[model samples]
Target: MTFSIPNLLSLFRLATAPLLALVFLVPENQNIANIAATALFLLAASTDFWDGFIARRINQSTSLGALLDLLADKLLIVTALLLLLDAERAPVGACIFIVGRELLMSALREWVAQNGKSSTVRVIAVGKWKTGLQMTAVPFLFYAGDLWALNTLAVGVWLLWAAAALSVWSMLSYCLALWRNE
Candidate 1:
């Protein structure tokens, strides 16, 4: 089975997620761990965009590649959320809302598919902004308790609030699209 470069990169990101979690969980090296975890998270997040670009450009898109890419995104996001919660850097309610949005969207996708509808889950522009805010907020929050200035945490909190707003809007957009299609 020949794997494309993008597919290999996705797999690599998935493989590193556990190690990232382990490093973050280490108590003795909190600062270094957070830095490493942030770097790993950024790298994995970048691959999310790069993989799709490469796939479309090279015509190497496959069902497996798509599935792997989605799974990698989930793993990275969920792991980061859990770590942020553990560190108490993130508000529990915000985390709950973010996770709920993800779950609801996943269910909506499955329901649409099961009803014999086209599974073209279009990522909305606002959803992209939501992801960008999250990718920034989670890492900053992870390092909030570190030696960084208090303003960093404050900004991260504000960003998290923005992300939550965007998440809700995106979820509503998905629901509306599904309803309109039906």
Candidate 2:
């Protein structure tokens, strides 16, 4: 596997996932922990875009890089969601919806692949918006306990619900497209 700068960055972000979780587990350093976690999360999320952009620009896109990018995104988001769930900032229903969507989508994608359908699942625009909403909300919720001045956590919860709604809509759109193709 050829290692490029962007791929290396993606790997670095993946490495930070566990550290972010560790930050949340420490009670005494909760505030600093939250800040650090937020920074790491944002950095990781940004790399999602950067890696893809760089790979496409330099014609360095490889199967491994694409897989690593997807894995990193999922890992970062799932890690943040679990942390939010632990903090009780993210509602149980929202967490369930998010996790459920991921599982169902994975299964559907696998089934499609097995059937010799298109291997590439294009990330739709709405899906991008959903991801943006999720990334923004999850961190705010994570840092909510630290900054009490504003109702950031509540806002994050609302955003989470919006993300869930968008996820459902996008999933339906994808399914419809597949159905139409079949």
Candidate 1 lDDT tens digits, 1-182: 44898789789778867877887887587778877877777787888889889999999998889778877776777788888788877888888888899998888778777888754467789888988898888767766654444666777778888888898999998888777877
The residue-by-residue lDDT of candidate 2 on 11-77, one tens digit each, is 9778878988887787577778777777778877788888889999989988788768767777788
Q: What is the alpha-carbon lDDT of model 1 when measured against the actual structure?
A: 0.80
Leading candidate by TM-score: 2
**For model 1, what is the error of residue 181's alpha carbon versus the real structure, in angstroms, after optimal superposition?**
1.2
Clashing pairs in 2: none
lDDT computed for candidate 2: 0.81
Scanning candidate 1 in windows of ten residues, the lowest lDDT window is: 143-152
Local error of candidate 2 at 48, Å? 1.2
The C-alpha stretches of model 2 lying farther than 4 A from their native spots are 145-149
